[model samples]
Every structure is written in structure tokens, then in C-alpha cells.
Target: MDGSFENAAGQARARVALRWRRIGFSALVLGSCAALLGLMAATLFVEAPDPVGIAMLLLFALTLPWTTIGFWNAVIGFSLMTFCRDPAGLVAPHLRSIGGTEKIASSTALLICIRNEDTGRLQRNLGWMLEGLVASGESRWFHLYMLSDSNQAPIIEDEQRVAAELSARFGSALSITYRRREESSGFKAGNIRDFCERWGSLHQFAIVLDADSVMTPAAMLRLVRIMQVQPHIGILQTLVTGLPSASPFARIFQFGMRLGMRSYTLGAASWQGDCGPYWGHNAILRIAPFTEHCHLPVLPGKPPLGGHVLSHDQLEAVLMRRAGYEVRVLPEENGSWEENPPSLPEFIRRDLRWCQGNMQYFHFLSLPRLLPVSRCQLGLAIAMYLGAPAWLGLMTLGLLRQMPIRADLGALLFILTMVMSFAPKFATLADVLARSPLRQAYGGTARILVSAFLEMLFSMLIAPISAVAVTLFMLGLPFGREMGWSTQQRDAEGIPFALAARRLWLQTVLGFVFAVCFWRVVPGAVWLWAPFVLGLAGAIPLAMASADPRVGRALAAVGLCRIPEEARLPAEPEYATLFAPCAPLSPTGATE
Candidate 1:
């Protein structure tokens, strides 16, 4: 009895310490942001005291902090990954001592949700995933369900055909089933809700997956074991990384993301604990809690912001936590994979959709029964999209305001801010070099360094254009411009030059205008603004070149960007020939 009391007291003390660490992290981010804003205010006041200048300063103060938050997140992540032991356990004490061999007493259903997705790719991935489970001899412990919200007739037909094929192949081996909805009312969230209302009671746990998602049987089993041990947890999200892509842009982009995400996820997990994130896919949920608590409410407004919440995952986490269940993320876990947009236009298109979804969070932040941390997370998501326009606005307003002096201090501060924002890339590189196996997997330190450098260059070039595009999308919202849901393009194929131009012309024009204005009206600042302008001006060509398979192949051959997953390829067969019969289907009948 005495030992039990002492253990409980020790656990309480550790929780207090963890809270202090999180508080310190928050202070570092907020305090640095405030200091940066003050410096910008001083610089603006010293230059021009006019209304435009004051507004510019105010906007700068508001926008600059978003970058600071990201900067500090990376910095803290780097520090933790480098120095800390038991990173996951540090955040949530319950997670620290979970028994690995916890018996899996709960029944789980593996769910795959789709909306007008490519049947062949879907079937291929499904087959491979099932094969993994069968190989692991855990197929009996899990049931597979294919849930579709595809509205198009031909696409639905294709889905049925693929279901027939999958049923034919795995009917005897596993319990596989399919269902399609005529109306994709609330999109993925609605599809899942339908499942919950009808079939959720049959299982104690559910593993949710997107159309492009794949996970190994061992990974799935680990997730289940964790849930079995930690019954208080409502959801457990995996740190999903991008699948291998042959496109140069995806190769470079995903490689950097894969490296950085490890550290960032660990740091975030340590802080978030029970108040963690849900990325909609590659996650497990406690069926009873989710069904009872996570039915999303219709925000009291019209379309977009007012109607059904588009960004439901984050809010669902909040609701689950409110209902006395923990929502969590496992950054150290593996065997989760998803596809990224293959090219720039596709990336922007996807970002636009997310931008609208995130922007809608403005309605829910003030909702009753919400946790303060959940509110902060929602605000941060809003700032992410808002920051882009804020940056663009700051630049445009700065260009217009008259400069009293050479603005040397402002220039220095800007450079420092840029460095802080980019520190994560460097930190990731440092981590790569520290691990010998990871370094060799990336083709040695020299190749890794080169890859990082190239990735940074291309990312900088891509950043401004994407920002401007997102800003425009946000602005279009009030005018009733909506982003409709559709199947995402996952291949890394080059788009037509004209199509690229059509998609990126606004950014090109904005870049050209900014360049000419700076050159004629503010020649001294042209050097500072040229990069942003050039990136936008050449957006079309850049997108095309980045998506070119030949370019991606060339870079890969030279070891510019290579992830370990590409080298290993999953052990499960690709089954390319099996998808051959479904190839001749029209694009209208299948997602590309």
C-alpha cells in the first residue's frame, strides 16, 4: 500500500514537470514572436509615420508570429530528438510504460473509405495490405471493409467491379466486404459516420484508412496492442510518411518532409499527449467513444464556414478529449504510408481545399466545452493559411510606403527571420549525419547534403507562389467561391505547359507586377524582393520541370534525393499485372 501511494505521487510529479516543459515551449515561441513584432514596429515607425506604414507594421506584427511558431516547433523538435531520452514517454506517462505484449482482446475493423478513387490502384493497395496481414498471420484478428461515397455512375461501377475482384481473391482468406453511398454528403467524415451508425457496435476498435493509405500487419497489430493496454485513449494517430515517388519534385519534397516530420512529430507528441492530432487517415479509434462523442455538429452558418465542418478530424479529437477520452499520436511508430500531390498545381489545388477547411475553424474556436489547447490548435491552423496572405500584404504595403533611410535594420531582421524559419531543414540534415545507417541509406553525407541544398532551393522557389495561391483562395470564400471534393492526383506525371500557365497565370502576373514596381519605384529593394517575384514569374516552367519523370530519374540516379523506403520497396508484391485488365477504363470512370 505504501509503495502504491509513492508510485502515484511520483507520477503526479512527473506530470507537473511535463506541464512546465510545455509551458516553457509556449513561452519561447510566443515571446520571440512578440519581440520580432516589436522590432518590426520600431523599424516601421523610424521609416514612415503614415497610415499605410502603420498598417503595414500592424500586419507584420500579426503575420510574423506564425512563422515564429513554426520556427520554434522545429527548434524544440531538433533539441528533443538530439538530447532527450524516452521522448514519447516524457509527454504522456501512461504511454511510457505500456506493455508491448498486452493481449489483444478487442475486436477491430480495418476501414478503407473512398470517393471516386481509381479502382485499380485501390484494389492493388488493398491486395498488398491484405497479403501483409495474411503473412503476419493476424488476418483472423481483423476484418476489412471498403466504404465508398462515389457519386459518379461509372466510377461506382468501377468500384463494384474492383470489389468483385477483391472478393474473388480474398473471400476465403479474410472477411472482406464493400458498401457505396449515393450521396457523399459530408465527404469522408460522413462516410465514416454512416459506418459508425450502422456497424460500429460490432467492434470495440476501428482502424481508419484513406484510399491511398497502406500499413503493414505488424504495425496494425502494434497499434491494437497499444489501444488494448491504454483503454483511456480515444484515438491513436500514426506518423504517416509519403510513399515513394519517381517524380523529382515529390522525391525531393517528401524526402525533406520525411526527415523533418520525425523530429517534429516526436516533439509535438511529447507536448500534445492526450490532446494530440488526428490526420483523418492512418489512425485507430475507440469505436464506442468515437461514435458517442465525435458526431460533428453543423456550425451555425451557410456553406463553407456555417454548414458541416470540413476539417472534422481536429475537432473530433477535441470532442473525444472533452468526453473524457485521450486523443494521441505515436511519432516513433512505423508502417504507415500515404501519397502526396505529384506536382505544383496539384499541390496548390490540395492546399486550397485545406485552406478553406481550416479557415472555417473560426466558427468553432469559441464553442462551449472546448479545451484551451484545442482552441490554440484551431487558431494555429487558421494562422497557417492567414500567414501567407499576411506575408504578401506586408511586402506589397512595404513596397508602397516611402522609406526614410536605407532600411538596413529592417533588412537584417528579415534575414534573421528567414534563417529561423528555415532552421528545421538544417536540423534534419544534422540528424541524418548523426545516424550512420540513415546517412548510408541516403547515399552518404555528401549526397544527403546536396539533396538538402537542392530541396531548400526548390522549396523557397515554390513557397511564395503557393502562399499567393492560398491567399487568393481564401479571399474567394466571401464571394461564394467553393472548393468541391474530388479524387486527388497521386502520380508524378508532367502537366501540359499550357495547363500549367492556365493554373499559375495569376501568380505570374503578380510576380511581374511586383518586379516592375520594385525595379522602377523601389530599385534599392529589388534585390530583397526579386526571389519572390522570380519564383512567381517562372511558376509555370518550374511546375512543369519539377513534374518531369526524366528530371526526377536523373536526380535519383545521381542520389540527389533518396529515401530508404525507395531502396527497400515493401516486401509485398506490387501486382502490376493484376491491374492490367482494369487499365482500359475511361478516365471519367476512374480517378487518375
Candidate 2:
């Protein structure tokens, strides 16, 4: 063989080796967690509970299985759904394609929500979308609105300045309104609700965008046209793909999310007109249904979690569905994108809120109005969020009792739960293969296959740490602190590897100690001894996007970029590009 051929083969082997290394590491971690959980299952007492213990266990029991089972199921089940070749969607398509129209027609409203945000970046994204909308000749029908929740008596001037500038720029064609109150309440939902009440009265519908989300002109109009046509649809949420930056972890996940989430999103969005959940971003909604039907109650309690639904989007979908409205995901739409958190710390901060909110779904699990598929989805979220702690608790109890690993119902559920969570990963693999172009995007099927083990390994490492975090939060809930609605960490500098490693050290230590303690007491199943301990120490950064430097090289070797390539857009000035292509909004001879 030629020396060049030999070198290339050697490099390929190295790639495969690195991928397996990560996978093995992950399996070790998961095996330990499952083993510990199995041990715990052997010890659960079926004895009658006193009122107090029964009440407490009632709270824990409802939440525990959902967390363990649901978490794993989403990861795995969604993975399978993504990979499957089935053409059926869970929801029926509501909007018909109106391709090749260049007329100034359909008047849709654009809603942009902001709260103490970087105005420049906000302006850039808004401009980006506006330019696209106008270029596509949909601007005449599309009015832009800047909804604000800035309430500083002092900095109020700056907020007003920005809003005023935006209004002046758009004039009567673009409507920009700002609502700054002394006391800001209800978070994003509150802000949006307030806007809907005031302006939702004016427009037919609005396409809502997160501060960082960049929606293309075509996507915005496509979403609006669909919502306009599908009157029963309260909110049309899309499957948001991550636009990763120049970071190791973000790039890999960008590919993972596209393949992992897109097909399932398509499947979920297609259910019997029963939209599973709206993610509150890059989706369009009719003004009347939302304003009239989407009033969020300030729940009685303080927040890490009181006073409102933490998972507001899911609950909103449920309420809408209950009120005889249609809520769903739009998979065929494109150009709506978001950036992944730059680091591990930021990632966890975002997840904690999800964990707390999804767990609250137990309160509505039995509601009769929701479709079976939607309910299954709600249940899935609960399981995914609470997975770690429940598994750990069962493991802890089993070791204390010195019992053999039970092969009964509980054990089966534990395994099934995990399979559901991760099944999505394998499915994602299958999805990439079916679509040949995405293979070019991901480097190659050759590389992707090699990378699966590393991906699996990443999952195993994060599970225990996540389990502990969820368990602590669940246990800590009686103290009555609500996890507040925190802004995500976007555009932040990445934490160094050494610092990130130290951050997880505490978790690693505790996981190891607990597993060892259990192994000493109940020495039978090696599964019991493997994952938890691995998970605990694996927190050093196995699954973390940026953890494996080899993965980083692999990503770069393929010319894969996470954030949207700027060259994809033209270099014309904002307004030049903004409305240049949008056929001049001919007066529809209609008044708003």
C-alpha cells in the first residue's frame, strides 16, 4: 500500500478509537448508575406507610419514576423516532405551501421580546429577519413590534431611546411599542402576555422570536402564512436547531440536535392536530386566540419555582388544547436558529429550570382533555427530568438492605426508562444516513458512526451528575424556594477545562463514595458497581460538548461550522437588504 494510504488508514483508526473510548467511558458510568438503582429496587419496602411518610412518599413517588423513566425514554425513544423511516407525523399539516409569491400581500405581525438585553445584537437579528421578510415581499403584511420589560426608573431613558429609534426607523409601516413598568412581574410569559393584550388587539397574528434567535425572512413569512391559513392553530412552534459557534462541544451537538431533533419534531408536530408542546420561540400565533386564551396565572408560591408554570410552553399548549385550540410544531419551516450555551456551567443552569418545571407536569397528568400522544409526551418530559435522583435513591436503599439485584417490575422500568432517553441517539444516527446531504454537513457517515460511542459516553457521564442535581432539587423543594426564571448564558466566554473539571469534582467524589459504600454492603451485581461510580467521576467531562479534544479535531477536520455561515447572506446595507426584495408594500387598500 502507498505510504499516504497507510497514513490515512491510521488516522481513520484513531478516529474510531477515540469514539469508542468516549462510549466505553459512558457505558461504565451508566452501568454503575443502573446497578446502584437495581440494588435500591431490592430494598423498597412495601410496608404500610403512616400518614406523614405516606404523604411525603406520595410526592416523591409521583415525581421519581417520571424523572427516571421519562428522562431516559425521551433520550432513547426520540432517538429511535428520529432514525425510523416511518413517514407518519403525529399531527396533521395545517398550512399549505404558497411558494413563488412575490406580491405585498398577507399582513402578519412580528413580535420581538426583550428584557435588559444587548440592544445591538437584538437589532442585528431583528434587522436580519426584517430584511428577509421584506426581500420576500411579505413585509407589507408583516408589522414589527418591540416588546420590552425594562423597568429601571433610572435607565428608563436608554430603554425608551432604543424603542424610539426602532419606531422612527420603521415609521407607520413598522409598529414598535415599549411597556416599562416600575414592578416587572411574571417573567417572559408575563411580558409576552402584556404585549399580546395591548398589540395583539391590533394585528391578525405575530411571529415571536427569542432575543438571540435569528429567523430568516422566508421562514418568518412561511410561518405566518401557515398560521394565517390554519386559524384553529393557537401557536405554531418550530423545531429549533442550534447554530453553534467555534467551540468543540457546540459543533458536535449542533449536528446531533439537527439529526436528533428534526425528524422527531416532524413526527410530534404531525399528530392528530394535537400539537405536543410549543417551545416559545421562532413560532407564529394568531393574536386573538393567544390574547383571549393564553392568560398565565401568577401561581400562589415563591420561586427556584413558584407563582407560574416553569414549563410555560408545554402548559400553554395543554391549556390551548383544553380550550379547543390547536398547538403544534412546524418541522418544514427553516432559518429559525439558536446558539447552544458555550459552557457546561451555563448548560446546567438552563437544565435545572427545565427539571423543576417538567416535574410539575405531574399535577396535570390525569387531565382528560389532552390527547393520548400529548399526554405521553408530557410524561416523557417528567421522566427525563427526574431520572437521576430516582435511580440513585433506589440504589442507595438497596445497598443499605443488602439485597440481590431484583429482576422484577421496578428493574424493568429502570432499564426501559433509560432506553427511552437514549433511543433517540441511535435514531438520530439512522436519520443522518437516510438524508445524504446532512452527511456532508456532519463530515461523513464514516465519521458519524465512529462518533456514536463518544456521544453515548457523553450521555453516561452527564447522567449521574444530572441525577444528583435533580434529586437535590426535588428533595430541596419542601423548603419552598422556586427556581427563578433565569436568562440563558449566550455569548459567554468558555470556561477552561481545568476549571470545568474542578467544578464537577464534588459530584464525582460523592458518586464514587456512595457506589463504594453500596458495593461493600451488597457485593453481587457488577452492574450495580459500575455506572454510578463512573458517572460521579466521569463528571470530569465525558459527555460535555467540549470535553474531548479529539472530538474537536474531528469536527474541524470536516469543515463543519455551527453558527450559520455569514457568507450565506448578502453584504448589502440593512435597509437595502431589508426591504429591497420585498415587493414595495402596495397599500392593500385595507386599514388596520
Model 2 local distance difference test score: 0.59
Q: Candidate 1, residues 388-478: lDDT per residue as tens digits?
A: 8888888888777776633777898878787777776767678779989889877798988888888877888899999899888888898
Worst 10 residues of 2 by lDDT: 577-586
- Can you give the TM-score per candidate against the true fold? 0.93, 0.74
Question: How many residue pairs collide in each prediction?
Answer: 1, 65
Model 1 residue 517 CA deviation in Å = 1.4
Residue ranges of candidate 1 with Cα displaced over 4 Å: 1-7, 92-99, 525-527, 569-592
lDDT of 2 by residue, 338-455 (tens): 7676555666767777887876777668867776546766876777765566556655655554323334654565565556555545565676666676665455666667666555
Among the numbered candidates, top lDDT falls to 1
Global lDDT of each model?
Answer: 0.79, 0.59
